[model samples]
Target chain A: AQSVAQPEDQVNVAEGNPLTVKCTYSVSGNPYLFWYVQYPNRGLQFLLKYITGDNLVKGSYGFEAEFNKSQTSFHLKKPSALVSDSALYFCAVISDTGRRALTFGSGTRLQVQP
Target chain B: EADIYQTPRYLVIGTGKKITLECSQTMGHDKMYWYQQDPGMELHLIHYSYGVNSTEKGDLSSESTVSRIRTEHFPLTLESARPSHTSQYLCASSEPMGNEQFFGPGTRLTVL
Candidate 1:
């Protein structure tokens, strides 16, 4: 079964500091990993995905995620934290063998202190 | 950009009321999905549609039902609303061969 895990329920970071939100996955074959962000009272917005390519994938709003196959992780990162970047983030995964629907992890709430 | 829209952004209704949440996309995507979410939580897929007149239930069992009568529209209907049904319902559409799914603003439903 393909599954994603975001261990932290919340992550707090000071403004201008680098931020990292941890994510790990379990799947049989090569995994399709994705990150999404959700603001208050808004639907989820896609951040990025790692289908097959470079280990590090850049995404919208100056965010990036690194896919570490050996560690079975795909951690989301930002060079500098911004107050507006605070939101709920989710990690999802799907494998070649399973159904098309993505399995998501319990989300992580990011609070960027101003 | 996304060209997807969901109607009744916020809805409050009494229990046992029959309600329909509307979703439409002009992106001409062939695959559409419906997910239920709680505030600041993970999303659970409740239903999905492959195309016009095609619908399938998702992993999470839902009392609600959906229809895809047209290529551009997919609406979910709950026969009898209950407090447990209260949640944010999201609609997403993806291109035929695209993995990235674009989401709509979502409908926040509350059952009283």
Candidate 2:
């Protein structure tokens, strides 16, 4: 079974400051990692995915993630955080057994203070 | 943009009442999924379908059932609504071999 973990339950950052949310995943063989964001009372929206190539993947809203195969981590990052960027972030990955489904992390609450 | 839609954005029902949460997508994706999500938590997959007339349970055990009668319609039903079943239900669809899964607005079901 493949699984992902978001170590921090919540991350608070000052507006315009850089922010980072940590994520680590465990899977058999190679991994296909992804990032999703959920606004209040809304379903998750796709941000970006790391299927193959490009260790550093860029996503929507000027977001980017670095996939570290050695550490089994794919942490989301943004250089300048905006108040509007505050939301719930989730890291997910597909199972190793050729399953069409994805296993998601517990989610990290990002709060950007103005 | 993903054109997936979930009806009854909010639903409240009494215990023992039977109800169905409707999910539809215009993307014509062969794969569809249903997930139960609580506030400030990770989503747990309840059910999924490969195509018409195909449905399978997900990682999490759920009392609700789902049916895939059409390529774009996947509805989840619960024979008896229980307070424990109250949560946000999300519908998602993906291409036969696509990487990203497009999600709907989600239906918040509250069983009293």
Candidate 3:
């Protein structure tokens, strides 16, 4: 079965500092990876996705993720974090195995302190 | 803008009551899904539909049942609400074989 793993439960960083949230996946075929952000009492907003080609995919809100095939990782990153960036982040994966629904990680709480 | 909407943004009902959570999309997408989520946790897919009159259970086992009678509407009904069913229910839609999904604000249910 295809699954995603987010190792960190929470990550704290200072405003303007670089931040990273780690993610890894296990799939039988090529993976379609995605990053989503959720604000308090709000639905998840799509950040970006990696279907093919570029290993580094850029997303909304100045976010980017690097897909490492050999390592089975797709980590979300931002050059400079803002206080408003504090939210819950989820990493998801969908393989070409004919499954329509995405397999999501446990989620990581990002706290960007001002 | 194309959007998905969920009704009863907040609902508090007593246990054993029957309740239905409604989801609709104006985007005309062929696929719609229902997901359950706890606070700051992973979302579990409970139901999905590829089109009208086509509904399927997802990865998670859920007591809620859903129907897709119209392409734009997908309503999930729980015959008897329980404390375990108290969570946020999210609705999403996408095009056929599309990777990106648009989600609704979600309905938060509290079972007392």
Q: For each model in turn, which proportion of the native inter-chain contacts is also found?
A: 0.60, 0.65, 0.62
Reference-based lDDT, residue B84, model 1: 99
Report the C-alpha lDDT of model 1 over B8-112, residue by residue, as the tens digit.
Answer: 999999999999999999988889999999887789999988898889999899999999989899999999999999999999998643287889999999999
User: Could you tell me the lDDT of residue A43 within candidate 3?
Assistant: 91
Give residue A109's error in model 1 in angstroms.
Answer: 0.4
DockQ of every candidate: 0.65, 0.72, 0.77
RMSD of each: 1.2, 1.0, 1.1
TM-score preference between candidates 1 and 3, better one: 3
Per-model TM-score of chain A alone?
A: 0.97, 0.96, 0.98
Residue-by-residue lDDT tens digits, candidate 2, A1-114: 789999999999999999999999998868888999999999999999998888999999999999999999999999999999999999998744576688899999999999
TM-score of each: 0.96, 0.97, 0.97
True contacts kept of 2: 0.65
- Once superposed on the true structure, which residue ranges of model 2 sit more than 4 Å away at CA? A95-97
Q: After superposition, how far is residue A53 of candidate 1 from its true place, in Å?
A: 1.2
Residue-level lDDT of model 1, residues A50-95, one tens digit each, is 9887999999999999999999999999999999999999998888
What lDDT tens digits, residue by residue, belong to model 3 across residues A49-96? Answer: 999998999999899999999999999999999999999999999887
